[model samples]
Target: MSSAFLPGFFLGFSLILAIGAQNAFVLRQGLRRQHVFWTCLTCALSDAVLIAVGVAGFGHLAMLAPWLDLAMRLGGAAFLICYGGLALRNAWRGGAALHAGGGDGSTLLATLLSVLTFTWLNPHVYLDTVVLIGSISAQYSDRLAFGLGAVCASFTFFFGLGYGARLLAPFFGRPRAWQVLDGLIGLTMWAIAAKLLVM
Candidate 1:
């Protein structure tokens, strides 16, 4: 069980550490101190649910439907490209700032919706959390332990990212920092979109 748990933990952490739209959104919300807890909880819980589904053999079901995968890929690419464009525009206008105010004018409901959309709508999430992790878990005799380990990884990462963002608050205090961050985010979004389309 320990062996399975360790491998699962590392696999999960490595995948989640990759910079992507989901991480970008979480970081931004964390920096803004707006709904950070809810955002993190949503992300972690969502990952856990997906991982469980995957481990339960949903990956096989997904493989049985090529059309569904294609549709998800196309939709995900479109969303990413649009989001990237918005981020680029924000960077250009110098409007991407970490406001010290209570909220960024985004209501709690809106924030949660955005967070959920970012999580569920991305095809990469399915590929990573469902297909990849699920396939990998089959190698371990104690698959349940492995799945639990992966779930723990999600909880650890999201909460850490959400709460730990404050440590960088001073650096992000500068307007230029926001500009650079948004610029990178825009590029990341575009890159991932291109990957999805090409793949």
Candidate 2:
């Protein structure tokens, strides 16, 4: 189990380093400096829960209920499409210039709900954190250590990303920068949704 720790940490980084919908949302929230701590914590904890489930050998649940994949795919695609459209609209409007100590005026509940939706509703998250991680952990004698390492990686990455975004505060002061960011995020979301549909 101890030997698997490093492998798990690196694997976790490899899997989550991609700029997916969830990551995009986190980046956006981080850049906005809105609910950074809670956002990062929620993402980390969500990954931890899924990792634990995977390490516990619950990956077979997907096999036991194949329909679950299709259901999640459809639901996820729908939500992504809607969210992507909203983002694109925001981009087109060209507002949302960043101000010091100011936020987008969203409530904490709304922010959490958005992050949770981005994390839990996305089928790819389950694929990466549960199925893939679970299957890989099975190869090791110390699955618990491997899972813990992956969990730690998750916590580290989320907090680092959420806080590290502040470094770009100077750049985001321009409204055009926010527009470009929103445009990219919208396109990314739509692309993921399209992939989900095709899958």
lDDT of each: 0.86, 0.89
Candidate 2 TM-score over all chains jointly: 0.96
**Runs with alpha carbons beyond 4 Å of true place in candidate 1:** 95-102
Per-residue lDDT tens digits of candidate 2, residues 67-134? 99999999999999999998898888986444523578999999999999999999988998899999
What lDDT is reached at residue 9 by model 2?
92
| TM-scores for every predicted model | 0.93, 0.96
* Candidate 1 lDDT, 73-172, residue by residue in tens: 7888898898899878767777434443234678889888878878887888998989999999988888888888999999999999988988888888
lDDT of 2 at 48: 98
> Which residue pairs does candidate 1 place in steric collision?
none
Top candidate by lDDT = 2
- Consecutive 10-residue window with the lowest summed lDDT within model 2: 95-104
How far is 70's C-alpha from truth in model 2 (Å)? 0.9
- Which model scores highest in TM-score? 2
- Quick one: how many clashes does candidate 2 have? 1
